[model samples]
Target: MSNFINKLWGSKSKASKTVTFGDSSFVNAPGGRIWTFISIATLILLWVLSSIFEWVKPIYWPPIQDVWSQFLVISSEGFRNSTLLEHVAASVGRVLAGFLLGCLIGIPLGFALALSKTMNRIFDPIVEFLRPMPPLALIPLVILWLGIGESAKIFLLFLASVWILALAARSGAMSTNLSKVHAAYTLNASKRQILFHVILPNALPEIFTGMRVAIGVCWGTVVAAELVAAESGLGMMVMVASKFLSTDIVVLGVILISLIAYVIDIFMRYLERRFVPWRGKAKH
Candidate 1:
């Protein structure tokens, strides 16, 4: 089993690092670093100039100082009787809960469809039928069935994530190299052993990839759900601010959502590195 495991991991003495924006080489590259700095600086310079000179109406593009002031007020005085932290927590909580639940069900279902012809035949049509449908379109139906509550919000997020994850898992499992399986069989490995030791490891990279995508989808779905109706959450805060024509607050909400998503994706990539180090290392 140890030998097989080593072989499965390509028998490397050390795992090669996956390329990411934060990777040392990428960050340390003088040309790339300089270009990135210039790009961001130029954009910020333009924003400041536009705001200072009133190139755009303040209603359309509030000054950066105004956005900062709003943030300070909300952080201390709170928004809609809920603290800013509470609003962030509410949205983050719903996203994680729904995404984790989808993972619990979707990954296994994907494996079943990939590994068993009977399972594929039975479930494929249903999956195909639902996969292309938009999560936004289901809001009314979900409200009818579950009402405009936390359950309804979570359900929408779950729907947004599940199908994407299922497809990722199925693609990963099906992409496994047949030669490795045949070799395992020749070595008298039990079916259970081959399935776990061989297939699961091979599919993990794809599963992680799917997870990244699903989380983004869940984030988008949660905001839309909250917009439809919610007492507290980032989306609700944004909706309320927009209604009042508070452009600064609206911009702050958008920036917060984008930053949160970016951080989560970075964390996911870190996990992928730790668990599936051989990912992107395999020779085609």
Candidate 2:
């Protein structure tokens, strides 16, 4: 038993090599960085040129300058009785609230499912059933039950994220190596220590992956819900602007949402790296 534990720890220490992106290596390469810049610049150049040359009507595709001017106006003069920042804040708040709540409930439920056969047998069917249903399709029912208040919107966002997170957690926990658990046992580690140190750590990477995906879904769900009925939000801004054919405001709202989502994903990646630096390093 002592020899086996030593062998396990030695192997783990030797396997401390960092993971690399392989095919996606260019993402961090200097040449790849240049290409990214060029790609974005080309699109911006085309947008500007299109406006100057009138390639597409302003109604269909507004000039970048027009969009910027509208942004300044909305930033100061306000849009639909609320400033641009307020709308953004409203949307972001709903997403964070619902997503955090989903994580709190879903992660434990997932761990329970992975650890207990009874929990799996009971909840697996319900999770699978709900997974296929579209969050948008639930709007009518959500409104019926929760009404068109903030609760309704938050509940919709919650539904969008919870199932995905639950599954991610279960997969992560189930994927923990039995050999590692046995090694812990051989070292006289208690079950609680093994669960916390071995199983939970092993499960973190999948949970982070699920979080990235769930956040994106929550953003989409909240926006769609706001479009249905909300006094404030980026989606509401877009919907209200469309009613008056205020294309620039609509474009601005979309750009803001996309930019925020991108930033959030970057943040999630940073957290994943910070918490699970050993992820992908362990040899099977």
Candidate 3:
């Protein structure tokens, strides 16, 4: 037993050496960075060339410079009377409220369904029935029930986000390897210990992925919700801009949404990395 323990604990002299700094790894690390920059540079060049030759009309595809100036104008005073920040704040607030509500309900319900067969049997049918209905399809009902106020917007965003998150949680819980659970049992871990220390940690990566996807869906749905009943939001800005044929404002609105979604995705990814250090570095 001592010999076996020593062999397991001792480091072998023939073990592979770790790579040091100033090696080939550094060269490989920068390849992805260079490729990303190149892609952006190529797109900018194409945009400039297209604008110079009038390859597309300004109405349909405005020049980059015009879009930049229009973005500044919108940022300063905005379309109609509302400023860009006000529109952004309103949209973000709605999404946050709805997303928080969905998370509060979805995460616990997901765990319940994943853990308890009885609970799963009870809720699965209802979830399946409602999951197929698009949030936009429920706009009229939501307005009628919630009175075309913030409640309607929140409900729509919640509807958009909850199903995706619930499905993700269910899948993650189901995918946890049985062997790990068995090992936990062999070690005499309690149900709570198995859940918190084993299942939840393993499920976190999938949960974050779901949240990233949910954020994108929420952004898209919030715009739609705002388009229907909002007085001031990025979606409302685009709708109003369309009536006046202010393509620049519309473009700015689209860009702003993209930026916000991108930022949220980045934050979620950072959280994933922080919590799931075993996941290693992300590719991009």
Candidate 4:
């Protein structure tokens, strides 16, 4: 018994799998960085040239400077009675609220399903059925059920994101090493001990992956959800601007959302690295 525990606990897995990106390892390579910078700069230059030359009508695609000027103007003044920063904050708040809600409900439900075959058998079919439904499709139902309020928007985002996290967590739990579980059982480890020590840590990597995917989904869904009826948030701003043919503001709102999502994704990645540093280093 002692020998088994020692071997199980002290085992170290050190096989490092090499990860490459297609034909070129562009993740952090210097050449890749240079090429990326050049590509983006070239794009900007082309945009500026097209705008200057009037290649396309200004009404359809405003000049880069016009968009930049609009951004600065809105940053200093306000947009639609609310400041740019306020719109950004409102969008962020809704997304976080929805994402957290989904995570809270989804993760536990997933773990439960993984731990109990009865739960899995009962709920798996339902989950699979609902998982593919688009959040946009639920907008009308949510509005009818909850009204066109923040709750409706939050619910829509929650619907968009919950299934992803739940499935990822379930997959992680299902993929746990059967041999290790049997060994733990043979050692007479309590259910609680096994759950905390063996199950959760092994599942952290998958949970993080789910979180990344869920957040992106939530962000995208919230934008569309806000379009239903919102006075604030970037999506609302885009919709309102489109009605008035304020293409520059619409473009600005899109850029802002994209930038915020990118930053949030980076933060999530950092958290994943910090919390699950042993993701690929686990000893089987």
lDDT by residue for model 3 (1-284), tens: 76554444443347545764645434323223545667889988998998899899888977888889987887897666777888899999999888888877777777777889999999999888988899998898888888878889989999998988888888778777888899999999999999998888777777777888888899998878886668889888888777888787778788899999889877887787678876534352
Q: Using Cα atoms with residue i matched to residue i, what is each candidate's TM-score against the true structure?
A: 0.86, 0.87, 0.83, 0.85
lDDT of 2 at 64: 86
Error of 4 at 149 (Å): 1.9
Winning candidate number (TM-score): 2
How well does candidate 2 score on lDDT at residue 29?
26
Q: Which regions of candidate 1 fall more than 4 Å away from where they truly are?
A: 1-31
After TM-score superposition, the amount by which residue 222's alpha carbon in candidate 1 deviates from its true location, in angstroms, is 1.7
Instruction: In angstroms, give how far residue 271 of model 1 lies from its true place.
Output: 0.9
Pairs clashing within candidate 3: none
Off by over 4 Å in 2: 1-22, 25-31
Q: Is candidate 1 or candidate 2 better by lDDT?
A: 1
lDDT of 1 by residue, 192-243 (tens): 9988988888999999999999999888777787865798899889989999
Error of 4 at 42 (Å): 2.5
Q: Cα deviation in Å at residue 251, candidate 2?
A: 1.2
Give model 1's clash tally: 0
Backbone clash pairs in model 2 (N, Cα, C under 3 Å; residues 3+ apart or in different chains), count: 0
